[model samples]
Target: MADLTGKRIVVGMTGGVAAYKTAELVRRMMDEGATVDVVMTEAATKFITPVTMQALSGRPVFVDPWDPRVPNNMAHIDLSRGADAILVVPASTNFMARVAHGFADDLLATLCVARACPLLMVPAMNREMWGNPATQRNAAQLRADGIVLLGPVDGDQACGEVGSGRMMEPHDVLQELIAFFQPKPLQGVRVLITAGPTAEPIDPVRVLTNVSSGKMGYAIARAAREAGADVTLVSGPTALATPRGVLRIDAHSARDMMSAVMGETPRADVFIAVAAVADWRVAEASAQKIKKTAGEPPTLSFVQNPDILATVAALPGGPYCVGFAAETEHLDQHATEKRQRKGIPLLVGNLAQDALGADDTTLILYDDQGRHPLPRQSKLAAARELIAQVARRLPAGRVPTLAARPAPGSPSAVPSAPPSPLSLP
Candidate 1:
């Protein structure tokens, strides 16, 4: 899944038979953890009820420009006040013209004209209307104005004739939404990441593993991909879905994860070791499930597991290595020590109790320079910032052009303050 945990989106619906599809788009965005506000033109309400949209978005649907919902009767501006993006689904030919010509006759139109965020529109219309020279001219103008036009994908339309003008499927539009928000800072770079807790077998049915949910690692993979890196994720038994556009390899144990990472590290430009590998494994795992005997408990011998991060970092000319340290105490001390011990350029530290299996995280970056604290936020947001920080530290020739910073209204645009040392768990 593409992580949109803290993204704020405004789904602008225009009147079209495809207006029904906008409901699913809004639901999909919200499903990915984005907060969606549904804005509708009066003509749009004719196709889909405001009640249905409101129910899906969990916020009041805005349709009337003079709606009392706004303190100053400025629904047009207020609805998009802090939005990260404005997506117009089933953008009718009329709506396209209105937008291209800067018309603000309706609330939706007014919002488009007044929005400070990126405007993305998915067009839907009759085949002839889409082919009309006038509509083409309007589209050209929209493109010229920096308005992103997704598609009036060629296919069957609501009308009997089927040449072009079908709205992009809700899921496809959702993919575009994810792509639009992602900043491609690591483009042309290949990132190899290990995530989740590697399990070491005590027996066929029992194993030793940590509390890792793979959320942070998975979040990093998503962020890396969004940063335009070709990401390969080596996961250890995570229930989470594969992030879109990532190559995923599964690992069952520490040895398995090591093999996977070592195999991919040669081609990677960056390597992130986020998995919590078992520190020890049974010296000899039992082939059969160990049975408890009433007389005495079976004695199990243990041996040290391979140190994945240290091993990778020790490799000659290895990818820029980044390690993760989850400490319950002495976070800064341990994190800094680990970076030196592992011979890595960067090490990320967080409280194990605070981050394990959780959606939110507070991270501190430890390097030769000093400690840099990142504000507590969703793992996805933190991952993006982490990637940016890594990009900045990359050797000059290896670094790629990065996407611009998040716009002023985005949650990520919030200023960072030094986190209190006492806050570490």
Candidate 2:
């Protein structure tokens, strides 16, 4: 199903070149199953015709407060009545100032004042204009009034000067909209996640790595961020963009991943180890590329890599740890045993052949209470469900502070046998 299914959105367009982008936003919202009602200001009509927005929304665009099409002649009141949210795209400085002080002179501004739903504004203007003290104060006032400002992210502006005040792209706006509706169960929580396949060097140009694409881990990071968690991702090599609002650290080898995880674990409320780390690494990797042999292949020695999950789980009063097991056979037996061996509160299991590098797969959560299978679905969906489960298991009150826990590499932080399993909800 689409993310915004059955959502009703009222899109308000103010005067700006970014109105072209809003056309795409309206179409994309509908594609995601949201019915959009476009409301344009007189200045907005000057930039982009109401006909264009009307064609995209498949409804008459409202410009005048007294739009005769509305049976009650109160377009502002009727348009925003049942809206899930009212988004003012490319909200001009004039419009923002007007709304900031409760001046409902225009149709869109009037609707905003009358609407009961949440209000989101996307600012788009020249860098100098956005940097102006007056504009800043207005922005602050709007925020203080419970208005959500999506972004006027720093980038090239239409006036050609590069700085702040660029409107977020249409696709990004759509993502923010989707996230705004998600439950913030992980709010104020710090999450540390490891993803992708760690590469262990055998030579300068040769390394051993698994087939993990990091899709599932990245999805979980996105889902967790959407749920309002402060997320940090320790990622192995992958060709994927960092999820918006996530701090990503790159880890190439198993040891690299272990070090990164250790450094971040002290601050985390929850730790999810999902990377397909190589179990072993070359004991004495060649300084240069290994030369190809004509008669026989070169023999290489191997040493076991440090177990990241077990190490974190062994930390006294550490973050709640969750592990992932991808098995080719005997999933239940292997997954349950691994969870116990690692001493983590939760373990997610799936068939390696079915899940690695795939867009969708079935996930089974193993905890103190036997197996709980989740329906096969997209990685993002599974990630959201997993995050929900993790949220439920978290203990009440704030996570332990840094002062309350030993530093990761200190002598007192040495690994011990896993303590009794964490109590699950």
Candidate 3:
């Protein structure tokens, strides 16, 4: 009934006090588009039993390898063939040993050893039991055998003990399972993004910068990485730490921002202007702090910075460019004008009051298809939606479109080669 419509999953339960958690896992996997088949280890039935699993998964449970009811009909082969993947939750130390040693003494173990599709295992046990060197070695072997190992997070345990080795919560495991099934949609695609707030210098010790916290942009970078895009994050000064697995080029002034973005635009498949770049900068920054004389406020001259988005879009056969607009009024009109004038394929506009320094945002995507409103959600979710739209709209490649060399005497400077593509996916 949830989003999963066509996926087929095989859920195996093993002996552990946390075995009950597997029922919720099966239910969630089914709700998210999976048809689940449940199998229970002998010891697991002693904890939560199989009738409950049968009711939750809507499939009869399998416990013994020699059980004639399902086997006479070639059910084992059928069950193995029907699933897209196999998942073992509450993978106890004993079960891990059985799997590692290739022992198929039970139905669940037999199916695991027999499945043709991919296998994923989520370990859950007491901290001391999980930390056993034998269990660690078995897990390493599983990884080497190409099994997907979901997290066994560190936290308090059910046995009145506290340390490493807790099963990841149901929701988090669901996310990992979904991500595991997702196609590398952005494979080999290069994306360039600008983030954070550029500083407008007033003096050595004072600078004017907006309240842009860079959370939204950083979230987008992570989502893009998850989507399998090689992402380059051109960032301005922000207090936030750089997200691991992203290429970050720091910029302080509008000039530095342009240089970072320009250097990475040519080879990019997509360019996102998420940075709140200062429109104007002090005409001349004081090399040192200007001391106050306790008199009238000093005047500072300002000059318009180079329009980076427009400059990149004007490149001949440039990358597919997208711009962001943080507007409070006349949002549609302004976004439409910016999209047309900047010649960008897409413009993502959100209310500044709702978006600035926030972790959630609602966005209106202005593109060739007109406006599509994305309801307020986590910045990561919004980023995924935006990227999916971009992917759907991406035209099949015809040629490698490099940025145009600047014409002689042009005001905007040409950027160097684009950053080499890298992705967490």
Q: List the residue pairs that clash in candidate 1.
A: none
Model 2, residue 291: distance off in Å is: 1.6
Q: What's the C-alpha lDDT at position 356 in model 1? A: 94
lDDT of each: 0.84, 0.88, 0.79
- Encode model 2's per-residue lDDT on 1-425: one tens digit a residue: 99999999999999999999999999999999999999999999888999999999998889888888989999889888889899999899999999999998989999999997888899999988899999999988876666778778899878888999999999989988888777767756789999999999889898999899999999999999887778999999999899877899999999999999999998998999999999999999999988888979999999999999999999998998999999999999999999999998899999999999899989999999999999999999999999999988877654743234443224343223211000000
Model 3 superposed RMSD (Cα): 9.7
Cα TM-score of candidate 3: 0.63
Q: Where does model 1 exceed 4 Å of error?
A: 1-18, 24-179, 399-425
* lDDT, model 2, position 231: 91
Ranking by lDDT: 2, 1, 3
**Model 2 off-target regions past 4 Å?**
398-425
Q: What is the lDDT of candidate 1?
A: 0.84
Error of 2 at 83 (Å): 0.4
Clashing pairs in 2: none
Q: Which parts of model 3 are misplaced by more than 4 Å? A: 1-111, 121-178, 239-245, 398-425
Model 3, C-alpha of 152: deviation from truth (Å): 12
List TM-scores for all candidates, in order: 0.65, 0.93, 0.63
Which candidate tops TM-score?
2
